[model samples]
Target: MLVEKNLPLQPFNSFGIAARALRLARIGSEAELQALIRHPDWSADQTFVLGGGSNIVLTGDVRQLVLKVEIPGRRLLRETERGWLVEAGAGERWHDFVAWTLQQGWPGLENLALIPGTVGASPVQNIGAYGVECQDRFDSLDAIDLETGEAFSLNAAQCGFGYRDSVFKHERAADGRGFGLKGRALITRVRFLLPKPWKPVLGYLDLERKMAELGLVDPGAQQIFDMVCAIRRAKLPDPALIGNAGSFFKNPSVTPEQCADIIARDPKVVHYPMPDGSIKLAAGWLIDACGWKGKTVGHAGVYDKQALVLVNRGDAEHPCTGGEVMTLARAIQTSVYERFGIRLEPEPVVL
Candidate 1:
């Protein structure tokens, strides 16, 4: 394993914010990772595990060593009466992996197609879209303890998957109240459990519209996959063209009474009642209602197409700083809270 110093991070993250890592290492295999933990010079340096860099915002130069996961491979490991069991290395691009699985006739991940990031990062955020969450199809994952240099695995429940959250997002303390893997575990591989007799998930209104437009009562998996991709492409700007993280904030959930209170004032508030007693509010609607869409603050701006996304209006010569992004984000949060009486939580991991 080679360790490089003073590496530029501008190209590593999706936000396209200019930054650098004090030291960086590209890890392609488990053995390489083991070597890193055992290396006398680099082993003890504080480190950060970077996947596809799709879900992170670099505020400034990162002092810690950055481990860029590059593990690669994909295959159907086994099949049971229940479904097909597929395994992909942590480094595989999430969207490409979804396409590969569909090409191989595994259809469960179609709803999540077109999401940016690596397979390893998927479980960390419990990434979801349309109507499916990673927890719904996750089987297990292999991760190495950053502290002990030991390999371990966790199932769905062990992952503690919640809405845009997982155990990996927290930290352990002396009291043991918040026990999270956080920087303590580096994911090496991930496995997916795509069930047998795959069925379509077109419960979302957008998907329903696509099905109706196509005049198909039952759309196949591939059809659904194409539909999701098309919908995302139409609604969300491509990062290569316009630098951005897919969604800027999580769709905040509220109680039924709170929903009624908001609806009483604004009859057009978009919301959906959940399986539980809570109701999920459309964060984008709240932001749009507060009049932040298509507004620019310095180099950071809200995406005109979708209010939920924040974009970088900068390029090589003059780029947007992460602080500006955060400033704009905070302003949006303040406005939404003042108008709706609810706090808006940003979705990206700001570093």
Candidate 2:
């Protein structure tokens, strides 16, 4: 483990939030991680496992020791009668891995192409897009307990996967049955089971529009990957140029009766019936309806093109602080709640 003092965090996070880690340690291998945990001075310190920093909002300098997972490798473990089993290191870039899977003739991960963060962070957030969730392809994962320095493995059921949630996001129940990994567990590697007879997921609205625009009936994985990348580029701002998390709020789910009430009041309210019978409302539409798009508060502003995104209207010399971003987010949430009686939850982890 290589240790650094007062590490600048702007380059690490996608939002480019200006902050610092009081102490940071980069663990590029399992041995390094184990050695660091064995050190008497550091073993008891509070540590945060940081992946790609894409899904977090650092409000201030992190007081806890930051353990940056950089352990890296990728390989096809084995092919089963049902599907191809692949594994990647905790620190591997998420989007690049998806693209690599396609290049190697694996078709299942194409729909999730171009998502930010690392493979280790993927399961924690249950990252999904275009109708394919991590849980759908997740085989299992390996991790180590920060306090105990003990290694353990878990399958999908143990993950407690939900919409943008998992065991890693919650605290362990007092009864200790449902384990919440969260800060306690540091993921080392992730494995994916991409099934055979891979079928295209063309049910998403953007994919449908792409198919119609191209005058094609069926699209392949590469085509879908290209289309998703194109659509995202057209809609969302690149973090390299503009600092922002992809989506600011979760699409609030409501019952059919509740959906009807909202639809009755606002005829143009956008919604879709989920397979589980809940209706998912468009959070961006609600925010746009409240006139938050393109509005600026301090260094934070709502993206005009897509109200779902919040941007950093600051430069390297003066980047947007996490406080400003959260303040703006809270305001948006309150407005949406007051107007529609629906509480909008943020997608990113605020720290």
Candidate 3:
């Protein structure tokens, strides 16, 4: 274990919002994670779990110790009659894991290509792209309770997954406070249930239309993976190159009645009703309708290619500050709220 104090975190987060942590720790194994949780000097409430740090923004210095998970390993756990179950350490980069699974000819997770973040954070947000979310293929995960340093496994149902949410994210105390922070449960490993029978999901109009134009009746997992990568490359700016978290806002899910009312007001309002009866509306369109496309304020600006993504247009000599990001975020939120009577929440975790 290594511990440091007053560390600057500009290199850690994708948003590039400069911030400092009071203390920082790196754990190399699950046992180390458990030991840190049990350390008398460290309080669960004062510790925060950090992975690849892609889906996060720090508006200010983190007052607690940021524990970065360094444990890394991946392998196929078993081969069932129907599919293969693969387990990966939570510290693994999400896209690398997805590409690895594809190399093995695994038939799931292809639609999730190029999503930023780590394996552990994947379940926290039910990370998804194209037309598939992580929950669709999640089997289970091994987590540690930060208070007692006890390990436990949670099945998919126990995860309580929803659009960009999970029990891990929505954790609440008996008094309606937050859990995980005080308990310090860290996701040390993730298990994925991948189907052997290839099921290409092209439900999104862009993908479905592309397939239709190709005159293809059925596409395989590899083809879908290539198409997803191409589409993502066309829209999302690679964090390694431009430094951005993909899709700064989630598509707002509303009630069918709400959707009907909005549609009556503006037929251009696009929405799709989920099987669960909730209607998902395009946040990008809403933002664009508010005339935020290609809009720039100071060093922070909305990406011209995708209104859902906010980019840092500032350079090294004039980097965007945390305040600027928050300011722009507030403006977007206020604009979307005024337009549709619903507040648009930022998708990335704003620390």
Top model number, TM-score? 1
Per-residue C-alpha lDDT of model 1 across residues 1-351, encoded as one tens digit per residue: 778999898888988999999989998998899888887765433899999999888899998889999999999999998899999999999999999999988889999999999999999999999899999899999999887778999999989999999999988776876668888899999999999878778789889988888897988899999999999999998999999988999999999999999999999999988898899999999999999999999999999989999999987898999998999999999999999999999999999
Candidate 1 global CA lDDT score: 0.92
- Clash pairs for candidate 2: none
Clash totals, every prediction: 0, 0, 0
Pitting candidate 1 against candidate 3, the one with the higher TM-score is 1
The true-versus-predicted C-alpha distance at residue 126 of model 3, in Å, is 0.7
TM-score, cand. 3 vs. native: 0.94
| lDDT tens readout by residue for model 2, 207-326 | 899889988788888999999999888888999999998898999999999999999999999898999999999999999999999999999999989999999998767779999999
lDDT of 1 at 25: 93
Worst window of 10 by summed lDDT in candidate 3:
176-185
Scored against the true structure, residue 250 in model 1 reaches a CA lDDT of 92
TM-score, one value per model: 0.98, 0.97, 0.94
Which window of 10 residues has the lowest lDDT sum in candidate 2? Answer: 40-49
Worst 10 residues of 1 by lDDT: 36-45
Model 2's alpha-carbon lDDT is: 0.91
